[model samples]
Target: MPTRRRFIKCLIALGAGLLPWSGWSEMLKIVNHQAAQAAILTNDSSAKTLDLIHPKDVSYLYHTAADDISALTASDFQGRRAGTVGEEKAAAYLIEQMKGLGLEPLGDLINKNTRNYSNAFTVYPVIEEFYNGRLTFRPGNSQDLRTPCANVIGGIMGKNKSESVILSAHFDHLGIFQGHLYPGANDNASGVGCILDLVRQLVQEGVKPKCNIVLAFWSAEEMGFVGSFSFLQNPTFSLGGLKAVFNVDTIGNGALNDFSVWASSDNEAVQAIQSAASEHNISIPLASHEGYNSDQVYFNLDHLPAVTLMARDWLNKNHTPDDVPDFVNPEKVALANKILYKAVKKIAY
Candidate 1:
């Protein structure tokens, strides 16, 4: 039998030193990942003794993340509108809270002078003028339009560390409209909170996947996945190395215990989602569905593997002032995270 101490030693030897004060739950997850790594290096079949980790250990992640959903959607953020001071504040908040997660700063998108983790980009938003009987578009925006939005990122490397898997969510929402701030709690603040909680907790336990985990908080999704599209076109890193993408968006409605997934017939991505849903006791009422309404659509349409999670009834509370954090159910957000955790674990390996 592989002793726990030996597993710890093996992890340190492989350059994944323990923090010494990590709890048993954290230790368990790290031990399992390191054991699997050791087995691969030694080519020893018996070394494949990694146990199925219990999800209960990291339950704190869900709670903290769920609770913070309110903060992310608070009036202080001014709706986290893409290209506005609100969006910048939200990005700064995420970067600050997400420190030490092993994520490298994205290319020139991030401000070079500042330490905020962001993928800043300049996008030419189409401004349509409703003049006469026709509408025409011009590249770029007027003074009032938000021009500079940022995508936030972080990561945890799996075994290979070269192949990549993306866990994404859009954090931008409609700005103040008609004297109302679109709190955007459900539009995607919840999604952002969930992914952050999921990645931060896993990294806390030093749990590594079998492929690099890319944590992407996209911007300008309201303007049509501008941030994600930018990254795909002129990637700081290649998307060709991407194995899969899981997008979280608008999951704060519907039955608090249920979820809806938009996954096509792509076997690897679809099957993994189904399997993880089943294992985690999350209900995916249908085996296959397709949607192009959210950030994942950019990847899925281009033939890159992707899946999206949203509520079946999210349409009710989305894109309005009512979409405030008060409408977000923390329990459901936590459950969504659990399902993704299982799904990512299954796919990354």
Candidate 2:
């Protein structure tokens, strides 16, 4: 049997068109249904029986999430900082994954091009200065600096194309600060992995949502939610019909079984998340508060009902060099994926 790393590499190569589908037949067999069933039955006694979707399906998705985290945290991506070559590489990788999953590009809808998966934007980051013990932000000029970044957007159309639900996570981290690498595995890569696996599970199960499901991999979130704000300013879809935005971030750390949720308001979206948790037998301690940071902040500022799911004890390694894949727990990431999957399904389906 091929190792998981080799299997993931083959999948990436296949998605990038470097390998033909016929050539990957043998490698694809590594994920055979029988193997998945055996793995689940042996590993998780509770999953010996089936549920809404096959337990084996969940196992496959879980492995995919782990693979995604590994890929994102790899050194080749250079911490995936916005405007850097590493970030570009990460975006290309994500585009290939989206294409492989049969998701349509939701970026650059006007231009039917190969690079349409990227929603390009420029960020003239504001310069902050402390004046008289008060922090102030000034408009960046040419003397300052400007960074070119893009958000990778993909989606699956639903029965009602007019309405949409967004499942988003930021893909950018603090590049390399002072000669140290911040892998950002738990800070956000975990969230991105969970969303990718959620999409994979939805596609594999042939689930047709009631509203369009947009998978947004935001960029430059560390620079104050720039990518999401850019999307709002120039949206490719109708914002009026947006049902809700479910954001996941920093779920790979802290207690494995403990989860926290912050919503813009106590709306149907929150209720949907709570109901999903209940149905899925996951415990989510709901905490409603204002000014919770993450990619969801922009949407909340626009009066959109959005909810963010995260775990505790993330601040210690958030932007440090210690934030690496070694510290991320696959089970915690898998749990986050399951909760988001059910919650999004409750709303979109």
Candidate 3:
């Protein structure tokens, strides 16, 4: 809200008595101008394209908390309905949609009898026996239950296997607690929407990657990256061929104008993201290993590079009931998806 002239005037006043007011003001202007010019120097520092995805649709992704997300937050165990039932339902629905989008199955997973979709992975197992009742307030901890948990993953094999990329999001969310249900409208349903939208875009645009593109919808991420970890343990494709992984963990929590990127310096995904961001004039709150978190962890652990891009700071409504659909900014999610598509086009190709 503060004007450039006012900013310079303040700077001049701060530097007064040390130099002439006129000279200080001139020097401040030159410094400010140079700073602004410096911002334009790098290709990865500017936003070039944004229309790749629509703004209104992005808003829709955030505000539409359709379907249940409680599955991600459910406490299931081995052999039992590990995690949440809602999560399992979400995974099933995602697989059906991916198949509808024409993604080919890479191998036999989960049931092993079927090769139609990616296998399921478990993030955490709820040992019902651990509940002392009085010690913890969470439900069903008193019963021993082995819940079978899994995340749905699919991919379009790239022309060049060695240069593959991953586009991922978590589809599971907090289940019902007591008599109430946590719809998880924005806590992550928004991310799933963005992912789905991208799938629609790829199918419509006939965009094929030089490198394989993995559409990953992680499970149990809310339980400490369980589903992602499981998938990495037994991936359908060779991890050696991976170039980078792009994760969309949460993007509809805030207004559409702001976005954030968490990337590891140890990988090449950082440059790819920076390049796309700059070209589209997108502003990214950048980071290195210090604050990077998302489904990209699997690749990072395997020494493969990756990035986590989102539209807003998820901590505000993260893990809370307030993370509903209305609080999400759809335009931001759409833009993030657009940027992601651009990044894929540049990096994988």
Clashes of each: 2, 0, 35
Candidate 1 clashes between residue pairs 3 or more apart in a chain or in different chains: 109-120, 158-209
- What CA root-mean-square deviation does each model show from the true structure? 8.1, 9.5, 15.0
On the 0 to 100 scale, the lDDT of residue 193 in model 3 is 73
Ranking by lDDT: 2, 1, 3
Candidate 3 per-residue lDDT, tens place, 300-336, comes to: 6777787777765666656555666666666777777
Where's the lowest-lDDT run of ten residues in candidate 1? 50-59
Which candidate's TM-score is highest?
2
Model 3 CA deviation exceeding 4 Å by range: 1-82, 107-114, 123-145, 161-163, 288-292
Candidate 2's displacement at residue 178, Å, is 1.4
TM-score of each: 0.73, 0.76, 0.68
| Runs of candidate 1 exceeding 4 Å displacement | 1-63, 100-102, 107-116, 125-146, 263-267, 281-292
Please give the lDDT score at residue 212 for candidate 2. Answer: 91
